[model samples]
Target: MRIAELSRTTGVSAATIKYYVRAGLLPPGERTHANQVDYGPAHARRLRLVRALIEIGGMSITDAARVLEVLDGGDLSTWQAVGKAQYALDLRRTAGPGGDPVARAAVDELLARRGWQVFEENPARATLVEVCATLRQLGHDDFVGALDEYAEAVERVAAVDVAVVARQPSVEQTVEYVIVGTVLGDTVLAALRRLAQEHLSRNAFG
Candidate 1:
């Protein structure tokens, strides 16, 4: 297929596809002639993934490029690539680890109690501390009290996520599934949560 066909198939513009190639987000196609390049299904898949990372995942082009680089280069295993990609997309890493000490202790306690073998430097630990601290500041003790429930719910969700990703047959497909599933899955989960809240609210308050 040509660039136009690739673009049409992926719903990305030809200009944007060219830009992605130039930006190193997508690889250059095979040169067929002096002015003709032939793109394959791999190119189409990559273009769609690029668009998903940027447009759906809310990742900047630079971040998306970094993730693609991690996936494309090195001999990392599929899970390792997925872990690195998740780290690359973790915006919380850019936030300094200066959250409340009390909240941090609580989060640490929660992790230890659950026996989760998360890395100490995981940015999400700090994010959890920050959220707990903010909730405390706002006097939302009742909401904060549900931390265990929230953790349990998310654990189940994570299980489902991994189960779905495990069905992919190839390493490339598995990594891509992780990237796309996790990024867009957050959005899907949030939307479903909102709908559930609304339904429950209506039932309870009516």
Candidate 2:
């Protein structure tokens, strides 16, 4: 297929496709002549993957490029990429640097006390640590006090998630659910939180 046909089929602009080709995210098409080129199914699949990473996965171009590099290099597993992408999206959405050392240390100690094994490679763990650090720097000592309750809530949520996964009949479906949940679950929780807030505000004040 020509660039125009590829663009038409993929709903991506010709110029953008060219840019992707130049960036090596999409392999360059075969040169038919000095100014003409022809693409194939590989190009189409690459384009789709790129679109998913950028649109559904909410990755910036640079991050998408990095992910493409990993996919192309064949060194990292797809599950690892999925985890990395989820972490990147969460970090982007939750804006704020790590809090002071005092707060971070407090959170770390709390986690240690709870016997929660902190995985250095897990982005979610890093995010929790950062949030705790920020809360501590803000002089919110109550945040430290809330660790027990929060841990309980986390456990409850994890159990519920596990139950949901157990209902799936196959390992593939279970893994798929986990990957999709990592991204979509945050939205579900946010919506639920808003509803809870509305209910509290309406009844508690009255």
Candidate 3:
């Protein structure tokens, strides 16, 4: 398809598509003529991914570009790519909410106790510690006390994800699936969490 078809089909403006191409977020389509470019399904998919990172994940162009760099060059397994995407979209990596000794120690202890080793660059570590610090600051020690339970639940979800990934027929498809899941699954999870919380809160308080 041509750029127009790609733009219309993806609901991405032609100008913005051009911008993405220039930004290296989307690859240049195959040039068919002096002024025409042909884009395939892969281009369409990548355009969607770029938009998802910017619109849904709240990632800056630079950060989205960096995440794509990992996708292209990291040679990571499906699970590893998915893991890195989670950390890449986090707002904390640039300037985290900061960590005092207590909160930092708790994060360290949580990781150690859970027997999970995450990348040193994962922004979630700092973000989690910051949340713990704020919880302690706000006298919400009980919420902070639920870290182990939360980690357990998260691990179960991770296990299910691994099972799902195992069913992918090819490594290429699996990697693409992970990227799509990483970008959009977060929104799906957050929306569901909100609805669940609302339903539970109404039952408890009303």
Name the candidate that leads on TM-score: 1
lDDT of each: 0.83, 0.69, 0.81
**Candidate 2, 143-204: lDDT as tens digits:** 77798787877777777876886686654444445544544565577778899899999998
Model 1 agreement with the true structure over 113-195: per-residue lDDT tens digits: 77888987666677788878888889997887888889889999999988988898877777777778888898899999999
Model 3 misses residue 142 by how many Å? 2.6
TM-scores for candidates 1 onward, in order: 0.88, 0.59, 0.85
* Local lDDT at 174 for model 1: 74
Give the alpha carbon lDDT tens digit for every residue of 42-136 in model 3: 99999988988789877789988977876676567766766665565575644645758899999899999999988767877888888889899
Q: What lDDT, from 0 to 1, does candidate 2 have?
A: 0.69
Quote model 1's TM-score: 0.88
Better of 2 and 3 by lDDT: 3
Per-residue error at 84 for model 1, in Å?
2.1
Models, CA RMSD each: 2.1, 5.2, 2.5
How badly does each model clash, as a count of residue pairs?
A: 0, 0, 0
Q: Rank by TM-score, highest first.
A: 1, 3, 2
